[model samples]
Target: MTTDTTALRLYFPISARASATRFWHRLSAPALAHHLINAARRSGIQQAVLHPIQSGYLKGEKLTHHHPEVTSMRHPQCVELIDSESALRKFLHDHAAELHKVRAVLLKCEIPLIPNRQAG
Candidate 1:
Protein backbone atom coordinates (compact mmCIF):
# COMPACT_ATOMS: atom_id res chain seq x y z
CA MET A 1 0.00 0.00 0.00
CA THR A 2 1.14 3.52 -0.79
CA THR A 3 2.00 5.78 2.13
CA ASP A 4 -0.70 8.32 2.95
CA THR A 5 -0.63 12.00 3.92
CA THR A 6 0.42 10.80 7.32
CA ALA A 7 3.73 10.25 5.53
CA LEU A 8 6.22 12.93 6.52
CA ARG A 9 9.69 14.03 5.51
CA LEU A 10 12.13 14.76 8.32
CA TYR A 11 15.39 16.59 7.73
CA PHE A 12 18.25 16.39 10.21
CA PRO A 13 21.22 18.73 10.05
CA ILE A 14 24.32 16.79 10.98
CA SER A 15 28.04 17.40 10.66
CA ALA A 16 31.28 15.70 9.69
CA ARG A 17 31.42 14.79 13.32
CA ALA A 18 27.97 13.25 13.18
CA SER A 19 25.89 12.50 16.28
CA ALA A 20 28.70 11.87 18.75
CA THR A 21 30.63 15.01 17.94
CA ARG A 22 29.98 16.50 21.33
CA PHE A 23 31.39 13.48 23.07
CA TRP A 24 35.04 12.79 23.81
CA HIS A 25 35.51 10.72 20.65
CA ARG A 26 33.78 12.23 17.65
CA LEU A 27 32.13 10.02 15.10
CA SER A 28 33.15 10.02 11.45
CA ALA A 29 30.52 10.36 8.75
CA PRO A 30 30.39 6.65 8.07
CA ALA A 31 30.23 5.85 11.78
CA LEU A 32 27.41 8.26 12.26
CA ALA A 33 25.53 6.85 9.28
CA HIS A 34 25.88 3.40 10.73
CA HIS A 35 24.63 4.58 14.08
CA LEU A 36 21.54 6.14 12.56
CA ILE A 37 20.91 3.14 10.34
CA ASN A 38 21.00 0.85 13.34
CA ALA A 39 18.70 3.14 15.26
CA ALA A 40 16.19 3.16 12.40
CA ARG A 41 16.24 -0.61 12.28
CA ARG A 42 15.58 -0.73 15.97
CA SER A 43 12.79 1.79 15.51
CA GLY A 44 11.28 -0.24 12.65
CA ILE A 45 11.51 2.46 10.00
CA GLN A 46 12.72 1.07 6.69
CA GLN A 47 13.33 4.06 4.45
CA ALA A 48 16.14 6.49 5.28
CA VAL A 49 18.93 8.31 3.51
CA LEU A 50 22.09 10.16 4.58
CA HIS A 51 23.10 13.16 2.51
CA PRO A 52 26.34 15.13 2.36
CA ILE A 53 25.99 18.84 1.70
CA GLN A 54 28.66 20.43 -0.44
CA SER A 55 29.92 24.06 -0.42
CA GLY A 56 27.48 25.34 2.22
CA TYR A 57 28.11 27.74 5.10
CA LEU A 58 26.99 27.81 8.71
CA LYS A 59 25.18 30.64 10.58
CA GLY A 60 27.10 30.80 13.86
CA GLU A 61 30.05 32.60 15.41
CA LYS A 62 33.44 32.65 13.75
CA LEU A 63 36.15 30.31 14.97
CA THR A 64 39.53 31.09 16.43
CA HIS A 65 42.56 29.11 15.37
CA HIS A 66 46.03 28.91 16.86
CA HIS A 67 47.86 28.01 13.63
CA PRO A 68 47.86 30.16 10.51
CA GLU A 69 47.11 27.33 8.07
CA VAL A 70 44.58 25.23 9.94
CA THR A 71 41.35 26.72 8.69
CA SER A 72 38.44 24.42 9.39
CA MET A 73 35.98 23.23 6.78
CA ARG A 74 32.89 23.32 8.96
CA HIS A 75 30.15 22.74 6.45
CA PRO A 76 27.20 20.88 7.90
CA GLN A 77 26.22 17.38 6.80
CA CYS A 78 22.62 16.16 6.73
CA VAL A 79 20.15 13.29 6.61
CA GLU A 80 16.52 13.17 5.56
CA LEU A 81 14.14 10.49 6.76
CA ILE A 82 10.68 9.72 5.41
CA ASP A 83 8.06 7.89 7.44
CA SER A 84 4.54 8.06 8.71
CA GLU A 85 3.70 11.01 10.96
CA SER A 86 3.17 8.78 13.95
CA ALA A 87 6.40 6.86 13.38
CA LEU A 88 8.36 10.05 12.95
CA ARG A 89 6.92 11.50 16.12
CA LYS A 90 7.62 8.35 18.04
CA PHE A 91 11.18 8.23 16.74
CA LEU A 92 11.73 11.81 17.83
CA HIS A 93 10.31 11.16 21.25
CA ASP A 94 12.28 7.98 21.73
CA HIS A 95 15.55 9.52 20.60
CA ALA A 96 15.40 12.79 22.47
CA ALA A 97 18.71 12.03 24.12
CA GLU A 98 20.38 11.46 20.78
CA LEU A 99 19.08 14.80 19.57
CA HIS A 100 20.74 16.51 22.49
CA LYS A 101 24.04 14.82 21.69
CA VAL A 102 24.20 16.33 18.23
CA ARG A 103 23.57 19.81 16.87
CA ALA A 104 20.60 19.31 14.58
CA VAL A 105 17.61 20.90 12.94
CA LEU A 106 14.45 18.85 12.66
CA LEU A 107 11.88 19.93 10.11
CA LYS A 108 8.60 18.35 9.03
CA CYS A 109 7.15 19.09 5.64
CA GLU A 110 3.89 17.91 4.03
CA ILE A 111 4.94 17.74 0.42
CA PRO A 112 3.14 15.13 -1.63
CA LEU A 113 5.52 12.81 -3.44
CA ILE A 114 4.64 11.81 -6.98
CA PRO A 115 6.62 8.84 -8.20
CA ASN A 116 8.05 8.99 -11.70
CA ARG A 117 6.28 6.89 -14.33
CA GLN A 118 8.12 3.90 -15.69
CA ALA A 119 9.16 4.00 -19.34
CA GLY A 120 6.95 1.66 -21.34
Candidate 2:
Protein backbone atom coordinates (compact mmCIF):
# COMPACT_ATOMS: atom_id res chain seq x y z
CA MET A 1 0.00 0.00 0.00
CA THR A 2 1.32 3.40 -0.89
CA THR A 3 1.50 5.51 2.21
CA ASP A 4 -0.05 8.81 1.25
CA THR A 5 -0.51 11.08 4.21
CA THR A 6 0.94 14.47 3.49
CA ALA A 7 -1.50 16.61 1.52
CA LEU A 8 -0.11 20.00 0.72
CA ARG A 9 -0.87 21.68 -2.59
CA LEU A 10 1.95 23.52 -4.31
CA TYR A 11 1.06 26.05 -6.96
CA PHE A 12 2.68 29.01 -8.66
CA PRO A 13 3.00 30.64 -12.03
CA ILE A 14 5.58 29.14 -14.33
CA SER A 15 6.70 32.50 -15.64
CA ALA A 16 6.37 34.67 -12.60
CA ARG A 17 6.43 38.36 -13.29
CA ALA A 18 9.99 39.68 -13.33
CA SER A 19 8.74 43.21 -13.04
CA ALA A 20 5.59 45.18 -12.32
CA THR A 21 5.24 45.92 -16.01
CA ARG A 22 5.82 42.44 -17.36
CA PHE A 23 3.31 39.60 -17.55
CA TRP A 24 3.95 36.45 -19.51
CA HIS A 25 1.10 34.75 -21.35
CA ARG A 26 2.71 31.36 -20.94
CA LEU A 27 1.64 31.19 -17.30
CA SER A 28 -1.34 28.95 -16.81
CA ALA A 29 -2.51 27.19 -13.65
CA PRO A 30 -3.84 24.07 -15.36
CA ALA A 31 -0.76 23.57 -17.49
CA LEU A 32 1.58 24.08 -14.58
CA ALA A 33 -0.37 21.65 -12.39
CA HIS A 34 -0.35 19.06 -15.15
CA HIS A 35 3.38 19.20 -15.50
CA LEU A 36 3.92 19.16 -11.76
CA ILE A 37 1.75 16.10 -11.24
CA ASN A 38 3.52 14.25 -14.02
CA ALA A 39 6.89 15.06 -12.51
CA ALA A 40 5.80 13.97 -9.03
CA ARG A 41 4.41 10.70 -10.34
CA ARG A 42 7.60 10.03 -12.19
CA SER A 43 9.49 10.57 -8.94
CA GLY A 44 7.19 8.09 -7.11
CA ILE A 45 4.94 10.44 -5.18
CA GLN A 46 1.71 8.49 -5.50
CA GLN A 47 -0.54 11.23 -4.30
CA ALA A 48 -0.25 14.97 -3.80
CA VAL A 49 -2.46 17.90 -2.91
CA LEU A 50 -3.29 20.12 -5.88
CA HIS A 51 -4.65 23.64 -6.05
CA PRO A 52 -4.24 27.00 -7.73
CA ILE A 53 -1.71 29.30 -6.10
CA GLN A 54 -3.22 32.28 -4.35
CA SER A 55 -0.45 34.62 -3.29
CA GLY A 56 2.85 34.80 -1.43
CA TYR A 57 6.01 36.72 -0.57
CA LEU A 58 9.78 36.24 -0.91
CA LYS A 59 10.53 33.04 1.00
CA GLY A 60 7.27 31.10 1.06
CA GLU A 61 4.03 31.89 2.77
CA LYS A 62 3.18 35.48 3.40
CA LEU A 63 3.03 37.33 6.71
CA THR A 64 4.51 34.79 9.13
CA HIS A 65 2.81 31.68 7.72
CA HIS A 66 -0.35 32.56 9.65
CA HIS A 67 -1.57 35.31 7.41
CA PRO A 68 -4.35 33.79 5.29
CA GLU A 69 -2.86 31.41 2.72
CA VAL A 70 0.12 29.48 1.46
CA THR A 71 2.35 29.77 -1.64
CA SER A 72 2.97 32.64 -4.00
CA MET A 73 4.07 33.69 -7.48
CA ARG A 74 7.74 34.17 -8.21
CA HIS A 75 8.70 37.79 -8.33
CA PRO A 76 9.92 38.90 -11.78
CA GLN A 77 13.62 38.95 -11.00
CA CYS A 78 13.32 35.75 -9.03
CA VAL A 79 11.73 34.13 -12.05
CA GLU A 80 14.82 35.02 -13.98
CA LEU A 81 17.04 33.11 -11.59
CA ILE A 82 14.96 29.91 -11.96
CA ASP A 83 17.00 27.84 -9.49
CA SER A 84 19.61 30.17 -8.14
CA GLU A 85 19.79 31.63 -4.62
CA SER A 86 20.59 35.01 -6.12
CA ALA A 87 17.12 35.08 -7.70
CA LEU A 88 15.54 34.70 -4.27
CA ARG A 89 17.49 37.67 -2.98
CA LYS A 90 16.09 39.69 -5.83
CA PHE A 91 12.61 38.78 -4.71
CA LEU A 92 13.41 39.95 -1.19
CA HIS A 93 14.60 43.20 -2.63
CA ASP A 94 11.28 43.60 -4.39
CA HIS A 95 8.30 41.96 -2.72
CA ALA A 96 6.04 44.83 -1.78
CA ALA A 97 4.36 45.39 -5.13
CA GLU A 98 4.05 41.75 -6.16
CA LEU A 99 2.35 40.84 -2.90
CA HIS A 100 -0.45 43.31 -2.88
CA LYS A 101 -3.40 41.54 -4.44
CA VAL A 102 -6.74 41.63 -2.64
CA ARG A 103 -8.67 39.17 -4.80
CA ALA A 104 -6.22 36.34 -4.38
CA VAL A 105 -7.77 33.06 -3.26
CA LEU A 106 -6.53 30.75 -0.58
CA LEU A 107 -5.80 27.79 -2.81
CA LYS A 108 -7.68 24.69 -1.77
CA CYS A 109 -6.02 21.33 -2.02
CA GLU A 110 -7.83 19.04 -4.47
CA ILE A 111 -11.21 20.67 -4.04
CA PRO A 112 -10.99 20.56 -0.25
CA LEU A 113 -11.89 17.06 0.81
CA ILE A 114 -11.00 18.24 4.29
CA PRO A 115 -11.48 21.74 5.56
CA ASN A 116 -8.36 23.83 6.00
CA ARG A 117 -7.18 24.88 9.42
CA GLN A 118 -8.47 28.33 10.21
CA ALA A 119 -5.90 31.02 10.84
CA GLY A 120 -5.60 32.08 14.46
Candidate 3:
Protein backbone atom coordinates (compact mmCIF):
# COMPACT_ATOMS: atom_id res chain seq x y z
CA MET A 1 0.00 0.00 0.00
CA THR A 2 1.04 3.55 -0.63
CA THR A 3 0.71 6.22 2.02
CA ASP A 4 0.94 9.89 1.30
CA THR A 5 3.47 11.80 3.33
CA THR A 6 5.55 14.97 3.40
CA ALA A 7 9.32 15.09 3.52
CA LEU A 8 11.16 18.14 4.81
CA ARG A 9 14.85 18.31 4.04
CA LEU A 10 17.09 20.94 5.66
CA TYR A 11 20.61 21.48 4.39
CA PHE A 12 23.23 23.28 6.44
CA PRO A 13 26.83 23.25 7.54
CA ILE A 14 28.03 20.80 10.16
CA SER A 15 30.16 23.38 11.94
CA ALA A 16 28.84 26.44 13.68
CA ARG A 17 31.71 28.45 12.24
CA ALA A 18 30.03 28.33 8.87
CA SER A 19 26.61 29.03 10.38
CA ALA A 20 27.26 32.24 12.28
CA THR A 21 24.40 34.03 10.58
CA ARG A 22 22.11 31.03 10.58
CA PHE A 23 22.47 29.60 14.09
CA TRP A 24 25.71 30.39 15.92
CA HIS A 25 24.87 33.63 17.65
CA ARG A 26 24.61 32.07 21.11
CA LEU A 27 27.67 30.29 22.44
CA SER A 28 25.72 28.13 24.90
CA ALA A 29 23.14 26.84 22.47
CA PRO A 30 23.26 23.35 21.01
CA ALA A 31 24.22 22.68 17.42
CA LEU A 32 21.57 23.55 14.90
CA ALA A 33 21.02 19.92 13.89
CA HIS A 34 20.43 18.72 17.42
CA HIS A 35 18.18 21.66 18.17
CA LEU A 36 16.14 20.95 15.05
CA ILE A 37 15.87 17.28 15.93
CA ASN A 38 14.53 18.13 19.34
CA ALA A 39 12.08 20.52 17.82
CA ALA A 40 10.92 17.84 15.41
CA ARG A 41 10.46 15.38 18.25
CA ARG A 42 8.41 17.93 20.15
CA SER A 43 6.42 18.61 17.00
CA GLY A 44 5.41 14.92 16.86
CA ILE A 45 7.10 14.15 13.57
CA GLN A 46 6.97 10.48 12.67
CA GLN A 47 10.66 10.20 11.78
CA ALA A 48 13.80 12.31 11.58
CA VAL A 49 17.19 11.40 10.15
CA LEU A 50 20.43 13.35 9.94
CA HIS A 51 22.67 12.57 6.98
CA PRO A 52 26.29 13.72 6.88
CA ILE A 53 27.42 14.18 3.33
CA GLN A 54 30.94 13.04 2.56
CA SER A 55 31.40 15.51 -0.29
CA GLY A 56 29.09 18.15 -1.59
CA TYR A 57 28.48 21.88 -1.89
CA LEU A 58 25.70 24.15 -0.83
CA LYS A 59 24.29 26.92 -2.99
CA GLY A 60 26.94 29.26 -4.42
CA GLU A 61 29.69 27.66 -2.31
CA LYS A 62 32.79 25.63 -2.92
CA LEU A 63 32.70 21.82 -2.69
CA THR A 64 33.76 20.41 0.65
CA HIS A 65 34.53 16.95 2.03
CA HIS A 66 35.38 15.37 5.37
CA HIS A 67 39.12 15.21 5.93
CA PRO A 68 40.89 13.06 8.45
CA GLU A 69 43.66 15.60 8.85
CA VAL A 70 41.48 18.68 9.09
CA THR A 71 38.60 18.65 11.50
CA SER A 72 37.88 22.36 11.37
CA MET A 73 36.53 22.39 7.87
CA ARG A 74 32.81 22.73 7.51
CA HIS A 75 30.98 19.76 6.00
CA PRO A 76 27.49 19.60 4.61
CA GLN A 77 24.64 18.05 6.58
CA CYS A 78 21.09 17.22 5.61
CA VAL A 79 18.24 16.63 8.02
CA GLU A 80 15.25 14.73 6.73
CA LEU A 81 11.90 14.78 8.49
CA ILE A 82 9.00 12.63 7.33
CA ASP A 83 5.44 12.89 8.57
CA SER A 84 1.92 13.88 7.63
CA GLU A 85 1.61 17.00 5.50
CA SER A 86 -0.24 18.93 8.16
CA ALA A 87 2.20 17.95 10.88
CA LEU A 88 5.23 18.88 8.82
CA ARG A 89 3.66 22.16 7.78
CA LYS A 90 2.95 23.02 11.37
CA PHE A 91 6.50 22.21 12.34
CA LEU A 92 7.79 24.57 9.67
CA HIS A 93 5.38 27.29 10.64
CA ASP A 94 6.27 27.02 14.30
CA HIS A 95 9.98 27.25 13.58
CA ALA A 96 9.88 29.76 10.77
CA ALA A 97 12.10 32.22 12.57
CA GLU A 98 15.03 29.84 12.74
CA LEU A 99 14.26 27.95 9.56
CA HIS A 100 14.14 31.01 7.38
CA LYS A 101 17.89 31.34 7.65
CA VAL A 102 18.60 27.86 6.34
CA ARG A 103 18.04 26.04 3.10
CA ALA A 104 14.90 23.97 3.41
CA VAL A 105 12.97 21.94 0.87
CA LEU A 106 9.60 20.31 1.28
CA LEU A 107 8.22 17.60 -0.94
CA LYS A 108 5.15 15.44 -1.20
CA CYS A 109 6.00 11.76 -1.43
CA GLU A 110 4.65 8.26 -0.95
CA ILE A 111 5.87 5.67 1.52
CA PRO A 112 5.16 1.96 1.39
CA LEU A 113 2.97 0.65 4.18
CA ILE A 114 3.86 -2.86 5.26
CA PRO A 115 1.54 -5.12 7.15
CA ASN A 116 2.80 -6.52 10.42
CA ARG A 117 2.17 -10.29 10.60
CA GLN A 118 2.71 -12.55 13.59
CA ALA A 119 3.84 -16.11 13.03
CA GLY A 120 1.49 -18.68 14.46
CA-only RMSD, every prediction: 7.3, 14.9, 5.0
Candidate 3 residue lDDT tens string, 1-120: 566688999887776322234454555556788888878998889999998677897787688877867743457778899998788888888887777657889898865667757698
Stretches of candidate 3 off by over 4 Å are 16-26, 68-73, 114-120
At residue 38, candidate 1 shows an lDDT of 70
In model 3, which residue pairs have backbone atoms overlapping below 3 Å?
A: none
Question: Which residue pairs in candidate 1 collide?
Answer: none
Q: Model 2 TM-score?
A: 0.26
lDDT of 1: 0.53
In model 3, which range of ten residues has the least summed lDDT? 16-25
> In model 2, which regions exceed 4 Å deviation?
1-4, 14-30, 52-120
Q: Model 1, poorest ten-residue lDDT window?
A: 7-16
Q: Considering lDDT, which of the candidate structures 1 and 2 is the better prediction for this target?
A: 1
**Which residue runs does candidate 1 get wrong by more than 4 Å?**
1-30, 61-73, 101-120
Q: Indicate which candidate wins on lDDT.
A: 3
Per-prediction TM-score to the true structure, in the order listed: 0.53, 0.26, 0.76
Give lDDT for model 3.
0.78
lDDT of 1 by residue, 24-105 (tens): 5544344454566577778888567766444344556343332344434443445555666677678778876665544444
lDDT of 2 by residue, 1-83 (tens): 22223333333443433232324434533343444444445545445344332334434434322124432234211111121
